[model samples]
Target: MRKPVLTIFYQYNPWQSTIGGIQSLINTFIKFAPDTFSIRLVGTGADNGQVVGQWHESELLGRPIQFFPLFTLLDDNVRKLVPTTVRYTAALLSKTLQSDFMHFHRIEPTLAARGWLGDKTLFVHNDIPQQMSSAKGAKTILWQQFPQLYFWLERQLMEQFDQVLSCNSASTKFYQQNYPSMVNRIMDVRNAVDTSCFKPLAPGPYQQAKQQLLDRLRLKPSTRLLLFAGRLHPQKDPLLLLRALAATPPESDIHLLVAGDGDLKSEVEQAIEQHNISSRVTLLGAVPKEEMVTLYQVSDVFVLSSRYEGLPIAMLESLACGTPVVTTDCGQGPSLLTSESGLVVSQREPQSLAQALVTVVDNPQRFTPEACMQAVSPHSAQHVVEPIYNSMLQRWHVSQANS
Candidate 1:
């Protein structure tokens, strides 16, 4: 018997080396999606005026991954009025036809490409209402360009996708409630991690990386390291973690590493200065993929101070690394962790997060490595993403029959 084949066209952030949930999700999909599925990702490249109108085929973790960049020639200044995503949508819309399934990772992208999508499409919504309702969303292209139709666009785009995968249960309900007509398509799925890459590391490389970081920080081995890995955006609220660090007792043997880069870089740097805890927090922007795993392994506790989320992949990756987490209310943290593994504080409260951090660092045995690994096992790619891949294929098959 022969295997059935399908092609998936994925769109998210531009093709760049960034540490993020959607980027990690793309990696997981590339590594774990069935051999029968051909993955073609579309994003603008930092191609330096070189690779426009070209298809670049590459491999990730030995699995084939293809990429296409639509608008690579425009200068950064020119891109302000005509964004890469806008260019991407314009070109795809004008194309003759496209792949079997078009999977998008954001609301605006789905809206931009709605006219070009088919019934087998998927939208991996992060947080529809929460993100869309924010002041940030108010400034997005959808609002700036078509202010009156943004909400209508959200409702209408829901009808275009065959499936909508939410990163957590709350987001699933958000979609179901806001777009009741498309409720049947919404699915609540936990974000997946590459267990193969994100497990507790043994003494050699892990120790080297940990020791290097410690030496560079000029800190003793006894220092408790709190790690925050994600974009420094309003949604992530990295400054909240810095504020919590400020609230901690002055003599506490704790240090924080914020491993990400974004629009809020200056704000975070300013907060560090204003708080006058420069020694307590180190803002190491955008650590590499392999080095991130090392940070996860060596860190005492992982942290997130996001205003809202749909189960952040960084959180899951941290858990998979056998690192306990202390985070503000978000994602599957409530259900995926126990008192023995992590703590989920009330949303947006720096004080509660401050105490939770101290508690997790103090009771290391309480948040055991064994427990963290077990808690995140179900979210491994084998257990979650493969099923999603198979279900998508099955749904697309049915769609073909109905047509």
Candidate 2:
């Protein structure tokens, strides 16, 4: 029997090295489905002078990946006036329809409108703009600006798909509540993490680099470190973390390592200074990927004070490093920690977070490094994700035979 062609559509190329949730999906697909399925990944190429064309191809981790350079020089005004980007995307979908099955990454209205879904089409739900806006109702002016037409179309096309996979339990709840017709087909398929490079670090060059970072940042030996990594954006709520840290005494022997960068870097820096914790907070900027494993190994605790998430990989990596986590009850990922793994605080509340941090530090025995590692077994790519990929292919074959 011939292996089925599994086509995956992504808005951005997986090689861009941007910290994104979609990258996790691409990595999981390539890692788990390479043998049973012939993978074809399609994405938008660089923003160059070219209009639209199949610009490049590369063998990424044993998968055939194609990038289409669509509207190279895309000015906001020009893109708004012309639907050339969508037109080109439709063409790409048209070409990829020969695949036995299709899996659309996110609920993009333009892609959904193109109607390239096969008998075994799968919709992976990451976030819902409509539900988000409704939840924030009066307080969210920014969320209200979301494209109404696009959101409505997303809801409409969701019902047209054959199967749906949610990133977590919360996402499943949201979809079931809003799009009941598709609930029967929906299943919880949490994001998987790659353990090849994210395991616990041993003493070596990585250890030397960790010491250098500590010395350069003037982090005292007695200082207990708490890390907040990922984008420095409004959604990430770094300001709240600063407030939580500020509630402690000036004499407190604690340090917060802010890793990653984004639009709110200045705002976060200003907030740190405003709290008079400049000496205690270290903005490591963007640390190289090779150094991250070592940093996680040496860290005392991992924390993510985000207002939203879809199973963040950093949290899982922290667990892989056997580092205990303390995160906000932002989404399904944090809730997975359970009482035995780490502390989960109230969302958007710095005071609550401050209390939780104090508790975590005061009773360090509550967090066992062994437990952290044990909690992450279900997310391992080999054990958890490979079966999901195989089942997806099997379902496609069964559907094709019935037709």
lDDT of 2 at 74: 31
Task: For candidate 2, give the lDDT of residue 30.
Answer: 72
* Candidate 2 accuracy as TM-score: 0.82
lDDT of 1 by residue, 224-291 (tens): 89999987777788878999999998777899998988767888999999999998888888777887
Model 1 clash pairs? none
Q: Which 10 residues in a row give candidate 1 its minimum summed lDDT?
A: 72-81
> Mind giving the per-residue lDDT tens digits that candidate 2 earns over 276-395?
889888887756556677777777778888766667778888887877888877666666796656889875677888777766666667887678888887887787677777677678
Clash number by candidate, in order: 0, 0
Best by TM-score: 1
lDDT of 1: 0.74
lDDT of each model, Cα atoms only? 0.74, 0.67
In model 2, which runs have C-alpha deviations exceeding 4 angstroms? 46-52, 62-64, 69-98, 109-113, 117-131, 134-143, 146-151, 202-209, 286-288, 399-403
C-alpha lDDT (0 to 100) for residue 315 of candidate 1: 83
What are the runs in model 1 whose C-alpha is more than 4 Å off? 1-15, 48-50, 73-87, 111-119, 134-148, 203-208, 395-403
